[model samples]
Target: MNDNDKQQGPDNGGSNPWMKNLLIWVGIFLALAVFVTIFNGPAQPAATSTIAYSAFLDKVEAGNVRDVNVAGEVISGTLKDGSKFRTYAMVQDPELTPSLRKNGVVITAKPEDGPPIWQYLLMQSLPFLLMLGLAFFILRQMQKNSGSGAMGFGKSRAKMLTQREGKVTFDDVAGIDEAREELQEIVEFLKDPTKFARLGGKIPKGALLVGSPGTGKTLLARAIAGEAGVPFFTISGSDFVEMFVGVGASRVRDMFEQAKKSAPCIVFIDEIDAVGRHRGAGLGNGNDEREQTLNQLLVEMDGFEANEGIIIIAATNRPDVLDPALLRPGRFDRRVTVPLPDIEGRVKIIEVHMKKVPIAPDVDARTIARGTPGMSGADLANLVNEAALMAARLGKRLVAMAQFETAKDRVIMGTEWKSLVMTDDEKRMTAYHEAGHALVRIHEPASDPIHKATIIPRGGALGMVVSLPERDSYSYHRDKMYADLATVMGGRVAEQLIFGYDKVSSGASGDIKQATKLARAMVMQWGMSDKLGPLQYEEQQGETFLGYSQTQRHNMSNETALMIDSEIRALVDGGLARATEVLTKHIDQLHLIAGALLEYETLTGDEIKRLASGQDIGRIDSDMKGPSVPAGGTSIPKTRRPKGPFGSPAPQGA
Candidate 1:
C-alpha cells in the first residue's frame, strides 16, 4: 500500500477528522455560552442588604434618600453618608416615587438593562443546537457501522483497503511461479498499457484464479494490488446477497459503478462461486436474489455498456459449479490455475518463510520440503512458523533441521499425545498391526517405498505405516491400488493371525475405512472392477448450490446394486487374504520388526529394513528419545491431486 491508500483516511476506525472538528466547534460554542452567561447576565441591584419598606419610608421622610430610580421596585439610592443600601417596595407603591420627589431625592429613569439580540438568541438556542448536533453525530456514526446513512443496504459492501497492515508486493510471493507470472504480466501491462497495446494486444478483462485452498490464490490477487499503481477493491461473493429481495442486484450495480469510477483498477471477488453458481440450482422462480445478482454482474462485466478499463480477478476452489456464462470468453476469459507447488517450489516457499526466523547454518530447506510432500505455499509457511515455535519452546538459539522435521510431523500427524498410556499387551498388538502393514507394502512390488513404521499413538491411531512415493503420479495403476488395499488390511490380518480371530481390537477401524474408500473408488469411480466390465455403476450425489437436503438415490437396480456390493466385498476379502498369506509366510520377520518396535517404540524405513535383515541397529541405546511430535507413518492418505507430484500424509492409520 502506498501513501494514497493511507491518505484515504481512517474509515469506520479511529477518530473522524470531521467529528473531531465538530467537537472543537462544540467546545468553542460552550465557551461562548460561558462568556455570555458571565458578561450578558442580569444587572446587579447595587445593594448589599434588604431593608424594610417602613425604614425606606422613614429614610425618605428624614430626607436620608438622595437619589432613586424606580424600576417598578422599591428604589436604589445612596444615602448622604455615601454608604449604599437597597430595599424592596410594593409594586403599586404610588407614594414611593412622589415621596422621593417631595423629599427632594434625585429621580432617575432609564431603559431596562439586558443582553443584546444576538447574544440572547445564542444563549437560547445553544442547548437545542447542541442536542441537534449530537443527534446528527450519533446518526452519522451509526451510519458508518450500519451502512450509507440509515438505509445503506443499496451501497456497495466492496471494501477498499484504507490501509494494509503490511504491504505484500510480488517479490514476497513464492511457489505457484507460473500463476505469479501471469498476474505480474497483467500488472505490468496496466502500469504501461501502451507498451502492450502497440502490438494491437488488449489485456484480458478478467482473470479467474482456480486453486485448492491454501494454494496462495488470494495472496496472488493482493500482490497484483501491490505491483500495480491503481485502485484495488475486494469483496466476498457472499457479501452481495442479503435477505432483502433486490439488495443483491443493487449491490452488484453499485459495486460496478464504483469500479467504473476507479477505472484501470482491479476488483477481486473472492469465492465468486458463492453467487455465480449455476442459476437453475436456486429457486426455479428465476427471481432468486443470488440469480438476479449473477445476472446483473454478468451484464455489467460484458453487457451492453462495456465496463472499460476495469479488470475483475476472482478466486475460487470449486470452479466446476460456476455458471457457464460467467466463464465465457468475454468475461473471465483468462483462467489461471494455482497448482500445489512441486518439491522445488516447496523448497523456495520454505526459504521465503525461513527468512523471518533465525535459522541454523545446517538447516536445509530442500530436505524439509522433500520430507513434506503435497504442502502448499501456505502450509510451507506454517511449517516454518511451527519450526520456529518448536525451537523457542526448546530454548534453542536458532531453528534447526531437527525442529523442522518435528514440525512437519506435527503438521501432518499431530503432536505426540504423551498422556495416553498403553498396557504391554496393547503396545505389542499395535506393533504387530503396524509391522503387518509395512511388511505387506514391502512385498508389493508396485507399492511406494516404506517411509517409516511406528506403534506410538498419534491422533486417534495406535500405530501407522507410511509410504514415500519416489515421484508424484497423476493416476494410480491397478497393481499399486491392490498394494494399497492389501497394506491397509494387513493390520487386521496380523491381529487375527497372532492374537486369534476374536482378539482383534478396534485399532484397525481407520484401516478398514481407508480400504473401503479405496476399493469403492476403484470399483465405482475408476472402473477397476472386472465384473462391472468398465461400466459406470455409481452416480455422484445431486449438485448443490449450498449443502441443502437433496435426496441421494441410486439409479441402479437391486440386482446391479447387489453385484456392486459383491464386487467391493470380493476386493476387500482378497486384500485381507493376500495380507494374511504374506504375514504367514514372513512370520519370523514380523516378530523381528515387532520386537524392534516394542524396544524402540518407533523406527524409520531403513531401521525396519535393517531389523528384517537381522543387521545390528547399534544406535538402539543412543538418540532413541521420541520426537516431540509423533513421527507419522507413510500410510497417511495421499493427496489425489494430479499436480504438485507431492505426497499427502494425513492422519491415515493402521
Candidate 2:
C-alpha cells in the first residue's frame, strides 16, 4: 500500500523519529558488547627468554683451571669483591671461567628472540579493538537519536478508506441543490479525466465547502469519492500539528506524496481553518508552526510541478479568515456555498428520511416543511427521527401528523412543563400580558395576524404569541418596522392599561431589549428615522464576530448624540402609543380573550379570532367545532382586515 493508505499508528512516545531510532541503536550496541565480552578467550604470556647471572657463581664453585673465562652476550666489565657486572647470560651446563691474563671474568650464555605471533597480535589488536567498540556505540546512539533511518517527520496523517468501507453517493445526501451542481463537475473530472483534457481545460485543484455546522459539508465530500469510485483519504487540520517544529509541514508533504501515488484520489480535510488561518495576523511574532504548515500547503497546491490527478477538498464555516493564497486561482478554484435549506429543500430532505419511517396516511411532508423554516438538512432528519420516536412511545403503528407537529413544537420550544405551579394571580397576569400582544396585533390594520397564543408556561416563558406570515418574505419596509415595534410594546401597554401601572419582570426583558435595539438601529444605522435625515450612524457588515474594533468617526458635537437618542425614543414612543390606542379601542374584546385564556390556558389563532369578535366563551366550548352562533343566531362583526405592506393587517378570520 502507498504511504497515504497506511493508517497512522499510535505515537511512539518520542517527539521525533531520530530520537526513537537513536534509542533502538543504543540498545543494539549494548547487546553486542555483552555478547562479545562473554565469549572472549583468556590471556597468554610472551615467548622472550631472560638472562641468568647465577652461572658466574656456579663457575666459582667448580674452581675450574685456576681462572675461568666468562663469556656472555655483552659483558660490561670484570667482577671484583665490591664491583658489579652487567651482562645477558644463560646457564646451559656452563662452568664459570675466570680469565688468567689481566682480568678474570665469569661468563654466562644469553639467548635473544622475540615473542610469539599470537602475543603480538593480542597486544596490537587490544587498543584497536577497544577503540572500534567505542566508535560503534557512539555511532549507534547518534543514528538512533538522529532518526535518519525512519521517515520521521515526513509521515502523512490522512485516513484512507478502502473498497471494503461503504461509500456515500449523491443519493445519500439530500437538499442543497446548488452546492451539488457545483460539485458534480468535480466528480465528473475524477471519473473521466480525458473529457476535460480534450477541451484543454484543467480540473479545479480544490473546492471549498463553506456552511454552518451540521450542514453536511463532509458528507458532500464523501459523495464525490463514491461518484468518482476512487480512494478517499480523510484527516482533520489538527492532525498536522505536533510538539516538534516543522512536523506539520512535513506531514503536509507526506500527505501530498501519498495522494500522488494513489492517482485520481481525493483528500478531504475537515475544519481546515484550524491550521489554515491567515498568515501574519496572529498576536506576537505569530505561530511559527501553523504558518510553516500553511506555507507547505501552498507549495503542494500550486508550487509542485504537477498535482498528478489529486484533488483537495476542504470544509470550514469561517471562510473569511482563510489565507488569501490558499484561495487563489490555481488552488481553491471553486467555492461552494451550502446554505440552510429552504421550504422545498426541507420537504425533499424530510421525504428522504421519511422513507425509512412508517408514516400514517395523514402525515404530510409539505406541511412539516412549511412549519420548519430555516432548518438545515440535519435538523430535518432529526425532526423525522423524533416524530417516529414519539409515535413509538405512544405505541402507535405509524407516525401521525400530530406527532410530527408536536415534534416541531418540541424542537422550537422546550418540553411541556405541565407540572410547573403558578398562583392564580400570576396566571391572570400572564393572560393579560399575552392577550395584550394578541389584541394589538389583531386590531392594527398594518400588523401581521397572530397564528397562536397560549398562557401555559413553555420553554421558560409564562406565555407566548407566535405571529407567522401567510407566505415567506425576504425584505422589510418602514411600515413593517413600525408594526413590529407596536407588537413588541403591546404587552407593556396592556399591563399599564389594565393595572394602571407597569410591573416589570425578566420575561419581557429580552423583548424590550430587542425592540429598543431595532428601533435605535432604524433611526441611527438604517436611516429609517425621519428627524435624523439619511445618515447611517452605525455600519454593520453582517460579520459573525461583530464590532471587533471601534473606529473614530469624524468628531460630532454632543448635541448630535443627544439628537440621535431623542429620535430613537420618539420612534419607540410612537409605537407604544399606537399599541395602546389599538388595545383601548378593543378593550372589551381583550377581556373576553383573557377570560378564555384563564380557562383553557392555551388558544389557537382561530380561538383568538372568535374571542376578538365578541363571541361568547360558552358557544366555543369544543376545540374542533367552528366558531359558534349566538342563541338567537346573531352575526359576529367582521373586524379582521387584509394585511398591508410591511406585513400589514391581513384580514383576520379568513
Candidate 3:
C-alpha cells in the first residue's frame, strides 16, 4: 500500500460520528473563547456616577429624585430623567428616610446576604475534589497492578506460557549437544511420569545449567517445555526479593503453590545466583532479604515430590556463589555444563544461523568455524548476523565469504580503525613487528600454524598475528608453553632487530605482558619450575557457586615468592633469547617479509610461506635494502643443529 493508505487506518475519525462531532465543537468553542479574551482583554465594571450626600438631598428637594434603595451601608437613587447615581450613607442617618419621603421619591429597604452556597462550591472546591478522586483511583490501580502494599506482597510475578505459546523446541537449540542430551530425560519425564514411577525411580528434582553468558541456558529450558507440551512459568531471581522483609519469602511460597496447582509444568528461574547467594557472606546486612528468599526456595523445593512433575530449571553463569543448601542432592540434582562450542559445534551453530540468511555458495561454514575457535553458540549466531548486516550495508545481493571474513575479524580483533593513520616509519615498524610473530610461530617446533598477519590497525593493536591450532588440544605440554611464550616475545625482538633499541615503540607492550603472565603461571600455578620441584605454590579459593572453583592465591613464604620471581624471569629470558637467536639466523627473511608487508599491508599464510621460501638458497635481490651475502657467505649452514630458545631443536627451515 501507498504511504497515505497505510496511514489511514481503520480507527480514523469517521469511525465514531458522535465522538468526532464532540471534538470539533470543543475545538471551535475553545478557539472562539480565546479570540474574545485576547481581543477584549478583561471585562470592565458597569459605569456609575458618585454623588455627595448633600447633592443627593438637594436633588430630592428639587423633585429630581425618582426612587431610592437603602441596602446595608449604601443608599442609591435614580433621577427623574433616568440617569443613574449612587452614594454611601450611614445606617443611623435619620434624614435618609425623611428626605426621600418629603420629595415623594420611592424608597425600598433590602436585607444584605452573601453569594449562593452552590456558586462558592463550584468556583473554589471542585478542582481539589476532582484531584482527590483521581489520586484515589491511581492508588487503587497501583495496588491492583503490583499486588503489594502493607499486606499483599506475597503474589508471584511469573509469566505463564502455555504449551502452544512455548514456541522454542529442541530443533531451535544448537552448539550445546551435551546440555541438550542432559535435558532430554526431563522432557521424557514430563511427558510420561508413569514410566519412571513403575520402575520405582524418582526423577531428579531440578537441573542447574551452568555456563558463561550466551551459551543458551535459558533457551534450553524453553525447549524442554515446548517438547513436553507443558505450561512454562519463568521468573527472574531478583523478582523474589523485595524492600520489605518477608516479601521475598512470600513470593517463593506463592510461586511454588502456583506451580504445584499447574503440576507437570516447568519453573525456570534465570540468574538464580541473585537470590541464592550463600548466607553470612560478610557483606551487606547480616539478615539479607536475598538470604530469606533462598531459604524459602530450599524449603519449597524439598517439599515437592518427584511424582509431582513440576520440574524447576535454573540458569546462572555464577553458580559458584549459590548457597550449598539450594544445590543439595534433593534440589538441583543435575548440574549441566553448557560450555562454549568446539570447532565442530561452531560449524553446526553457523549452519543453523545460516539457514535464515541469503548467503553466497563460497561462504564456507567449516572455515568460519575454524577461525572462531572459542565462540559460544550465541556468538556464532551474532557473527552470521553481523555478516548479513555488512552485506546489506554494501548493497550486496547475498552475504559472501568476504563479508564473513571481515565480520570474523571485527568480532575477534575488533573493527578496523581506518581513521587511525600512522606515518610511514610507524607502518614499517608495525609490519616488521607482526612479521616477527609469524616467523617465530612458523619455525617454533611446538607452536600452532600461523593463520594470518596484518599491519592494519584494529581495535587497540597497531598490528595482529593470528594462529590456529590444527586440532583442539586439551592439555598444554612444557615445550608448547615455551613455544607460545617465545612467539609472544617475537614482536618485541623483531622491533629491536629491525629498528635499533632506541627506535622501538611501545606496540610490544601487550605481547610482553602476556608473555610475563604465562611465565608466572607456569612457575607458580602450573608447577613447571624445576627449582620449585613440581610443588604448587598457589592456593585455590572456594567456588562461589556450582562448585566450579579454581582461582589462584599466592600464600607462599617471602623466600618462596622471591624464588618464583627469579624462575619466571628465567623462563621469559630464555624464550626471548631463543626468539632473538632464531631471528638473527633468519634476519634476511625477516627484512624481506617486512618489506613485502609494507607494500601489501596484509598477508595470508600461503603468501607468508612463499615470501619466506623465496629468500633461501642464495636467491638474492640486490635492489632490496637488506643484507646481501657474498658468493662464499653462508646462511645458518642448514646443518648447525642448535637448541631453540624453548630448549627444543629449531625447525629445519629456521
lDDT against the true structure, each candidate? 0.77, 0.72, 0.79
The candidates, ranked best first by TM-score, are 1, 3, 2
Residue range 198-264, candidate 2, lDDT tens digits: 8788888999999998788998999899888888889999888777889889888888888887778
- Clash number for every model? 5, 26, 7
Q: Which candidate is the best by TM-score?
A: 1
Clashing residue pairs for model 1: 465-635, 466-633, 466-634, 466-635, 467-634
Top candidate (lDDT): 3
Question: How well does each candidate superpose onto the true structure, as a TM-score?
Answer: 0.80, 0.69, 0.75
Worst 10 residues of 2 by lDDT: 645-654
| Model 2 accuracy (lDDT, Cα) | 0.72
Candidate 3, pairs of clashing residues: 319-545, 319-546, 320-544, 320-545, 321-544, 321-545, 578-645
- Ranked by TM-score, the better of candidates 1 and 3 is 1
Error of 2 at 27 (Å): 21
* lDDT per residue as tens, model 3, 503-616: 777777788788898998898778899999787777768754444567675667889888888999999999899899889998877876776666556677766777777632
